[model samples]
Target: MVSPLFITTFTLLFVFHLNHTSTVRPKMHINIYMYINMCSSNILTNDCLPPLNDENDFLPPLNDENDFLPPLNDEIDFLPPLNDENDFIPPLNDENDYKKFAIKIPEKWKKKEWIKWMKQTEEDWLVFNTYIIKKKKKWLARKEIKWKNWIRGMEKKWMHYNPHIYREFKSNTMKKSQSWDDTQWARWIETEGKDFMEIEWEKWIYQNNKYINEWIMNQWLQWKNKKIMQWLMNSWKCEEDEYWETWERSTIWEKWFNLRKRRKWLRWHNRINKETDQWNKWVKSKEVIYTKEANNKLLEWINEKRNSFNNWKKSFIDKWIHKKQWIVWIREKQNLPCTI
Candidate 1:
C-alpha cells in the first residue's frame, strides 16, 4: 500500500510539473492535465501507488517548445498626494524678498545683474574665438600637408622619367625630337617631292601644317581645363561664406519683429545661394566648340590624304610609262610562258 506522505509528495510534484509545462508546451500541458486527473481519481478510489525513486520517474519529459510567459500585472499603487493642510505652508515673504520666479528685477538690482551677465558673456566669447582659430589652423595645416605630399609624389614620378641633364642644358640639345621624326623625318619629305608637282607638294605641306596646329590646340584646351579644375578645388572652402552670414538681432528688432518673419529670414540667409552652373555652362560650351573644331580638322585631313594619294598615282604614271610603254608591258606579261 502507498503511504500518505508519498501520495502528497507525488501530488505536489504533478502540480509543479503542470504549472511549468503550461508555460513551455501547451500541447504537453493537456497530457499532463489528463495524467493529473488520473492521479486524483486513483487517490479518490484509494488505489495503491508505486513509490517514485526520482522526480523524473514521476514526471515524463515534455515537448521542447518554449513559449513566452504572460506578463504579470503590477499590484502596487502610486504614492499618495501630500495633504496641503498637514504638509504645505504658503510663503509669508514680501514680493521683493529675492525668491519670486520672475525675470524682471527691480531697477536697483538691474545694474549688478547686467554686469555679471556681461562678464560671463565676455569669457564665453573669448574661449569660443580661441577654439575657432585653433580649429581653422589645424584644418589648414592638414590640407597643406596633403597638398605637399601630392606635389612630392608627382615630382617623384616626373623625375623618374626626365633626366637632370635636360634641366642643366639651355640649348635645343636638351629638347626631345618631335614624334613625327621617328616616322618620316627627312626621307619621305625629300624623296617623295621629286616626282610630284610643286603645287601638289605645297598643298600637302599646308594640310600637314593645319593638322599639327589642330593637335596643338587640342592639347592647349586640355591643359587649360586641368588648371581651371585645380584652382577651383584649391579655393572651394571660401566660395560660399557670404551665404552663411548670420543676421544680428538688435534689441529693438528682437523686441518688435514677428517670430515667424525672423525665422523665415534665418532660413533664407542660411541657404547656399551661389550658382554652380556657371562653370558647368562654360565647360559645356568649350567642349562643344572643341568637338566641332576637331571634327572639321579631321575631315580636312581626310580630304587632303585622298587628294595627295590621287596626285601621287598620277605623278607615278607620268614618271614611269606612257600609253605605248604600258601596252608593250601588258603584251610581254601576256606572252610569257605559263609556269604550269
Candidate 2:
C-alpha cells in the first residue's frame, strides 16, 4: 500500500535528480534504507538462503596441526639420569677386579675369625695394588716425558732456523701501552663534559704473588714502627709476650720452636743407615734401553752364540717359555743345571 502523495513526491525528486546529474546517473535511485531493512529480515528468516557450508559454520574449526609452536625438548627429557630418582649411588668401576677382595665369607662362617681376616686381607691387598699402580703410573709418566723431550728437541732444532718468533711475541706484548695502573682502565668523557673517573679497584688489582710480597714488607715495617713507638712511650712491658725482664732481654720466644725441634730430629734420623732403613720419597727413575747399552748387550749375546762352551752353556739356559716339550726335556735332562 504505497501512499500516492509519497509515490508522486519520490517521482518528482527522481526527475529533478536526473535533470541535475550527468548521463552516468540512472533513471531512478533505489532507497537504500528500505532495501537494507528488507534484506536483513529475509536473511534472519533464511528466505535469502544461509551459507553453503552451514554445517562447518555451526561446528568449531581446528588448527593446521603445523602452526607456530613453543620451545622444544632437551637431553634430560629423553633419557633422564639415574640420579633423577632419590636413591644413593653405588660403588665404582674397576678394570682389574681382583676376585680375592670380592670373595665374601659365607653366612655360616661370619662367626669365625676368618671373616675379620678376610676384610683385613682385602684392605692390605688394595694398598699393595695401589703401590703396583703407582709404579705403573711412574713408568708411563717417564715414558711420556721421554717422548715429550724427543718432540721438544725436534721442535727446538726447527726453531733454531728462526728465533725471531719469540722476539715478535715479546714486541707485540710490549706494544700494548697500558701500564700497571691503567691496565684495566679506559679514559672516557663524562655527561657534564668533564673526565669520568670510574675506579673499579676490584677488577683492576687481583690477589697475586707480587702483591703478597709487597703486603708482607709493608706489614713488617708497620709492626716495627709500632714496637718502636711502644718503646719510646716507656710502656713496653718486660714480658710483653712472656714472663721476662725486658721485651728484648726476656727469654727468647721462637715462632717455629716446635718446627725446629721436629726438623732437627728428622735430620738426625736421616744420618743413620739409609739404604736399608730409609723409605725415599723420590721415585726411582726409569732404566731406558739406550742405543749403546742395547747394542753392547746384543753383541755380547751374539758372541756367546759363537763360542763352543758358551753355546753349550746357553743350551742349558735356553728360554723354556717357547719350548713345547719343556716338561719332558726337564725330566730326561735332570742333570742340566737350571739358569732360570
Candidate 3:
C-alpha cells in the first residue's frame, strides 16, 4: 500500500500543474470528457467565479438578432438612421451644419452692438440720411435767419481764426482743372489729306469709328511701352541696345552738333594731311642730308677714331636702312596711332 503523505503530495503536485498550464484535460483513467462537460456547464452559470475566457477575449454566442453588439466588417449603429436620404450620414447638430455651409442670416440675427444706433425709418436708409440733414438745416435756418445771416458774416471773420486751415480746404476743393489733350488730334491722321473734308478720309474715318481707333491706340501704347522697356534695358547698368529718344538726348542739340563736329573733323583732317605731306617732304630731304652728313661724319669719325668708328657706323647704318620712317613719324606725331 502507498504511504498516505506520498499520495497527498502527488495529488497536490498534479493540481498545481493543471492550474498553471494549458491543455489541462485531466488525463485520468475513466470518464474524462464527461467530467469536462460538467465542469464547463457549472463554470458558465457560476457568477462569483471570474471567466476563464475573459483572458482570451472570448464572449458567448448571442441568441437574439437585435442585440447592441457591433456587426462584423461593415459595422453600423443599429438604433436609427437620421438622414432624409439614406446616402447621407447626418451630422447630429444643426448649428454645426449651418457653420459648415457658411450660411448668412438676416439682420435680426446680426451681432453688432453698434447696430442699435441705426434708426428704423419709413424711407430707405441711403435716401433718408440726405432728407434728414436737409430738413435739419432748413428748420434751423428758418427759425433763426438773423443768426444764420450773422454766422454767414462771421465766416469772413472766421478766416482770421484759422487762416491756413481755410486756405488749405479752399485750395484742395477749388482746383484749376486741366482739359485733356485733343485725342483726335493726337492720334495719327488717318488719311493722306489733312482735313476731315476729303471723301476718302471721311469714308475711312467713318468705317473705322470705334474698333480700329482702339486697335491703333493699343498698338501705339505697345510701341511706347516697348521703347521705354528697351531704353531701361540698354541703360549704363544694362546689357542690351538702347532706345534713345529726342527727350532723353535733350542736352545734345543734334543738328547743330553734327555740323560742328563734321567741320572740326574735316578741318583737323585737312591740317593733318598738310602736315603729313610736309612731313614726308621733310623726311626725304633729311634722308639725303643725313646720307651726306652721315658719310662726312663717318669719314671724320674714321679719321678721328679710325677702324673703331667704322665698326659702330656700320651697325648704325644697317639699322637705319631697315627702319620704317613713316611708321616712326606717325608714332611720334599721333602718340599711339597704331591699332595694336
Query: Which prediction has the highest lDDT against the true structure?
Result: 1
TM-score ranking, high to low: 1, 2, 3
Q: What is the number of residue pairs that collide in model 1?
A: 0
lDDT of 1 by residue, 25-114 (tens): 454445556655656555534333333345544343445322121222321112233343232223536543322212112222323333
Compare the candidates by TM-score and give the number of the best one.
1
Q: Could you give candidate 2's per-residue lDDT for residues 196-300 as a string of tens digits?
A: 111211221232223433543454346435533443232111111122112224334532344432332333234222311321211111112212343354345
Q: What TM-score does candidate 3 reach? A: 0.13
lDDT of the candidates, in the order given: 0.41, 0.32, 0.34
Question: Which residue pairs come into collision in candidate 3?
Answer: none
Ordered list by lDDT, greatest first: 1, 3, 2
